[model samples]
Target: MADKVVPIKEQKLMDVKLGQLPSWLAARDYSAQGIFLGFKAGYDRFFNKYINVKNAGIGGFAMLMTGYVILSYTWSYSHLKTERIRKYH
Candidate 1:
């Protein structure tokens, strides 16, 4: 009796989609539990969705390039201003 292992359910041909996610989210608005669930959803997006097997390489590369561009512009803003001043001088 103790050796039984339960397998996860596989997708079937006619799967039924459940409740409206938006309505459910709206129902939990501004409460502590809602905030916790929001954090969990954010973590799931960043960790699970972003780093998944199918598009992980492309998605990660795109994200890295975007971050690099934004940070590069931000970090070099002062230098760019100096160059602009030097050019106009």
Candidate 2:
């Protein structure tokens, strides 16, 4: 029979040891999925883990609002800077 494969997070929760604290924290998944989609992995994990069906009214709204404000400000600031440069040159 084939042995069951454990997920990284679940394996950490189930079998981590005090002596292996340093190594455990330093360990990373080097699988193709983890390596190729590192940024996407982290992004998906964060949204899946923290921004779920529950609290969509509170935390989700807050996160969306904050992201909107930040991106809008950044775009406006960059546009203004570019306009200033265009005026000079």
Candidate 3:
């Protein structure tokens, strides 16, 4: 008798492919989830469709927004004031 291995299918959700993806990502187990999620989310340059606030929670969103505001303000202040400070006498 000869030994052989058989594969089993687990929890697969139905989806439609909008475009073709490379075979490498399909073969990679670790990256498969990310690829699936990215497609589901409609991965454009901006405006990602799958904005999961429930998963992130209010505090997480707040912190992220706060960080964005703080960084932007700092960048603007630095660029707008740098030349003025150098010229001040």
Candidate 4:
């Protein structure tokens, strides 16, 4: 029986054209301007649409309570003084 040799396909690297990117990403002001716009949009949506006075008050109170508990525990640990015992001959 004769054996048949099959050729393997070679992978090729694709060239990225500038036009392939979105208009915002392809613009020269993409880095800082785009990031600031995105951050502003997110901040606006979060504070305006999602957050309110009641939610902010509750969140702040919870955070304050947590901080107080942590501070109390740390203060107690930091105030404990070590005692040494001495033996007399």
Q: Write the per-residue lDDT of candidate 1 for residues 3-87, one digit (tens) a residue.
A: 5443223222133235444444444548898689878977677767667656566776588689899999999999888887665
Evaluate residue 69 in candidate 4 and report its C-alpha lDDT on the 0 to 100 scale: 94
**lDDT pick, better of 1 and 4:** 1
Q: What is the lDDT of candidate 3?
A: 0.51
Error of 3 at 57 (Å): 2.5
Position 9, candidate 1: lDDT: 33
Candidate closer to the true structure by TM-score (higher is better), 2 or 3: 2
Tens-digit lDDT track for model 4 on 22-87?
A: 432444245797689867976676566435455554664575578799998778864543322434
Scored by lDDT, model 2 comes in at: 0.70
Candidates in order have lDDT scores of 0.63, 0.70, 0.51, 0.53
Once superposed on the true structure, which residue ranges of model 4 sit more than 4 Å away at CA?
A: 1-29, 52-89
Candidate 4 backbone clash number? 0
Residue-level lDDT for 62 in candidate 4: 70
Candidates in order, TM-scores: namely 0.38, 0.38, 0.27, 0.28
> Which stretches of model 3 miss by more than 4 angstroms?
1-56, 79-89
lDDT of 2 by residue, 1-89 (tens): 99787644445534866776666656766788878787796678768766766655567658868989999988799677877766543
Candidate 2, 28: how far from true, in Å? 8.8
| Candidate whose lDDT is highest | 2
